[model samples]
Target: MGVLLTSCSAPSPTPAPRPKVAVTTQIKQLLPATVSNKTAWSEDIYQAFTHQKLETSVSNLCSVIAIAGQESNFNADAPVAGLPHIAWQEIDRRAAALHIPAFVVRTALSVTSPTGKSYAERLDHVRSERELSDIYDDLINTVPLGQQLLGRFNPIHTGGPMQVSIAFAEQHAENYPYKKGNSIRKEVLSQRGGVYFGALHLLGYPANYTVPLYRFADYNAGWYASRNAAFQAAVAYLSGVPLVLDGDLINYQDDKPSQTELAIRSIGFTLQLSQQNIHQQLMLGQSIAFEQSPLWKQVFAAADKKRGQRWPHERLPGITLQSPKISRNLTTAWFAQRVNQRYQNCLLQSRRE
Candidate 1:
């Protein structure tokens, strides 16, 4: 008490690297639902992490959960109004195109399936792609004429709950640990395991981009559209050609050709890529091969040299949403950006916890 004692302060603890932990665990726990959905989400994250060699952390899973939750609310069996009408329209159109009689289609469906249930009953009530797909499978296997008449009736969809791309599933089927002959609907509904794994495929796939919008565009359009659109934009700006930076690599909507192909043709002479080559390349957009092409490399080099720095190879456009519900020039870039903003907020909450 006579002498003043010097206060000794404890050293401050260094914070751990956030990316190492937050990026994996937080993300995994972010995708929430009933017990089943939680299980599915977990399995999917584990499989994706294992297969992609991604860091098994919550941050990465959270980013994916943010997207999936926004897209489908984790419902693999989600329903859409007027889908049955659309499916019937598609069935009629395909049948007409193939010159199959409606009565024949009906008769084939009327035949009893292996389950002893008539396909017509199922077909009449089917209001979603998954249901429609089951009917199609029955027709192909049980009905003799189904093989020839409606073999291509499999309306492989790439959107909606889980934002699952059928093409993506087929491409990465090897990574799926489940047994064969499992229906897409069943695989998609596996709350504790398979569905979540599917969600990972839809949301966890990697992309080298500065923002989440690019990944969203890839989710909607194709994997490299973000980068490809940038290259196309660069080409347009440099070549003085008009182009839309909407991140669409191929237009699968219209019966007409893709707008991207049209743009390519417009500048084909200057780019020295033949129309046939362009078409072939467009076909490869669904796969990873397109990214490895000379065309892609050339564009990157050209874009880099022009910018005098390594600009983002791709970017999400500033545009409006133009879904079936909303018409007018819409952009996935806008949707992704908004969702990403929400994701960031969620990330902050996780960090605080």
Candidate 2:
């Protein structure tokens, strides 16, 4: 009855159709001004950002650009300085580990690959990681010794424009938009696939770090490494036991709690949590929920009381980067700092434009 007499409110004027933000266009616009290969980089990165559904926020975009700049200088097929030597070294190391004769390993690589060149030949001429990865693929598929020597583990752990983990791409490839050619390893070496997977790995996880610096560290170290490192600091403070501040809570290879976990447990009576409770909470270290646990809160409270001041809840993990490729002593803090500097530069570039 009221509807018949009262004038309609005209459907609230449809909220004026709030202007749609053109993320792809924005990315394309921003990327060209920053990257050297303006058109190509913009197109590939835009496609990647769109496919992954990652936020096109300036911070997120700059984070990706910063990592790519530091990793490969935005070259998808970036060349390693001594990749051939590195490949040979890996082969020799693997052979020695397996107790396989060097002659046999040499003979195995001598067999012609699908590309009609011997794997040894490919290795000798290898310049970029993509080339090396292709050779490994050929060997793994065609040679029996390849399976035995490598055992399903590719020595080329990291690849692509952003140098994302090949294993990470393989694991999170459920919604991959590319065709399954060869494997995720090959796709990770491609420009579009690499950026997509790398961006997903870098920005995919939820973090509550106050600064992007922590996220940058976590990107190099591991997810939640920054937060876990802070936890380690707290445990160290409360127990007066020195801890490495490495983000690992437990020994990943076994069910035992790590030194950090042990130190945290030493204060369990004060925390009002049992050993099992601490273990359970620390087990969730890979996730953001660990920050909300009683262990996280109690440890920080106790440590802050001891220090007479509150410690910053995030810090660069004290992990020494151990990789065959690394020639210098590099820590997680160093990597994070470098990336953050690049990230800040990118932000400045964006603002200037």
Candidate 3:
């Protein structure tokens, strides 16, 4: 008692906190020598982690660095090889669908724009997404014929070094640190905005993945795609219903239940869940909370018992990536694996230093 009292009375003094090192120094060690403007890249990346309160651990940092490297070898507005051709094609396609004649559309674009160049001329020389966006903005605002032909629609879905979804950026822009530009789309085309939003999209969500590969897949596919794919696997195992394993639990746009949802409904009697119950649970599929839901637990449990083995909860979502930009066969698995290789290389580089 006396010794305890003495120890309590003489409590040790707390050591001073270690001085913080700049994240740029750490980022420099991970970056390749070929990366231009190393300081700028590092600063934006550092601020991304800082603003989002994400752990700037080597693994996390490397993941962001790898994705940026993969998406655009560090260019803020990386030029698309055939953006003008792509843009013109899309414009003509849109006009055709709207029943607007090609010559009328062509004549409208030939008018002098605010840049003192014809819109068609601007489209001809456009190399990057950012430049295309500005031209689109001017077209919609200035030209009466442009509003009739294109309306408010700008088909550019993604931009910037990370090529983040403009829709995703706008939805998550409330917490964006930099208060630049009126539009999130414009911000997404900048270095700071791209990294900030990209990092958030990459690491903002929670997952039970043991490896970063599933998370990488989720990034390409969508949030929680990996987990939902595993659940679909379990459902397929339990019900003898073949599923696409595409990680889509519900068809948000369609009123009819999706295949995965219907599959779960087929075995609802075994799960003691009704179709409504199944759907209610399926609605949570987009979130981490879905992992803890009763449907997730029951499906896996039934599947495990039937097979006499536990099914792995994490699996790469099997999805073929389709985009106007893509000219070859590429899958979500390919993107995930490629980025993961880069991620591992960054880690290896950091270790070597």
Candidate 4:
């Protein structure tokens, strides 16, 4: 009776507190030593990574810096040489495509704009992409003919310090933390928003690449381009049908199978899969799941059997960078290699620091 006050259970163990992550400090430390305006760049990058809830590891930080440096050289409002001429060419091309008279297009642009200059004058004097993008936005929103001619598409495909796709940003703008007054195009031109979306584009997805170089290639091409290119190589090797390793699974616009898909289908009988099964697997080219599909396994198996050794599962996609902005011949491999060089340099700088 004297010992009846014994406790039934011991107290629960206290959980350890997580160490506080100093995001801004980490970013500042990881940034390249040669960067001009390091403070401003670091602040914007920190805000972007934090707001987007992205990992702020040195590799991740350096990847962002590498792309930003290559794309815009840390200039948020980077000037595009001959932007005025580019704008005019686009307007003219669009007008011709829409069958709108040249005079009508000219007259529409001659109207006084919000900035007290004629839209024509603004187009003539567009020193940077941001200026041209603003002009296109105004034309699409205000001018009736503009809407018909441009079809709500602004030709400023890439913007901001990272040159992220405006379309990609718009698609993923649901959790965008900033107040939503401006369109995604406008946001892509801002330092913070551009970095946010660009980082998301560059680091948001899952991949099985052993090196950051493939991810950089995917950034320039499309997601999973490296993997899909490898798949294409396997298909080509097994089927004896040469195919461009562009990573396009399907002809998105039509139900017709892409050349790569068709090549895979040609070997369907050998793989013991139907055309439907092959198509289904190839359709997953955009995602990581494609690697798990039967077609993926069979193609590699066949290729390996033929070669008497296992072929590497990833390769630099053989895609030419064919943007109006790019005057020189460039490939996805070239882009990835260039960015990887920068990334390596950044890594070295971080280690030195």
lDDT of 3 at 5: 7
User: What is the lDDT for 306 in model 3?
Assistant: 88
Worst 10-residue lDDT window, candidate 4: 1-10
lDDT of 2: 0.80
Q: Per model, how many backbone clashes are there?
A: 19, 0, 0, 0
Candidate 4 lDDT, 26-145, residue by residue in tens? 666666666677677777877776666665667778888899988888888988887888888888998898788999989888999888999999998888788888988899898898
lDDT over C-alpha atoms for residue 182 of model 4: 64
Task: Give a tens-digit lDDT track for model 3, residues 308-328.
Answer: 999888889999989877898
Cα lDDT, model 2, residue 243: 92
lDDT of each: 0.59, 0.80, 0.85, 0.81
Taking all chains together, each candidate's TM-score versus the true structure is 0.69, 0.89, 0.93, 0.91
Per lDDT, what order, best first? 3, 4, 2, 1
Give the range where candidate 3 is weakest over 10 consecutive residues by summed lDDT.
1-10
Q: What is the C-alpha RMSD of each candidate to the true structure, in Å?
A: 10.4, 7.9, 7.2, 9.0
Q: Per-residue CA lDDT of candidate 1, range 256-296, in tens?
A: 65666776677677567887787777676545466677566
What value of lDDT does candidate 3 attain over all alpha carbons? Answer: 0.85
Question: Where in model 4 is the C-alpha error above 4 Å?
Answer: 1-21
Candidate number with the higher lDDT (2 or 3): 3
Best by lDDT: 3
Off by over 4 Å in 2: 1-36
lDDT of 2 by residue, 30-128 (tens): 553446765566666666666665556677778887888888888899988888999999889889999999999999889888988888999999999
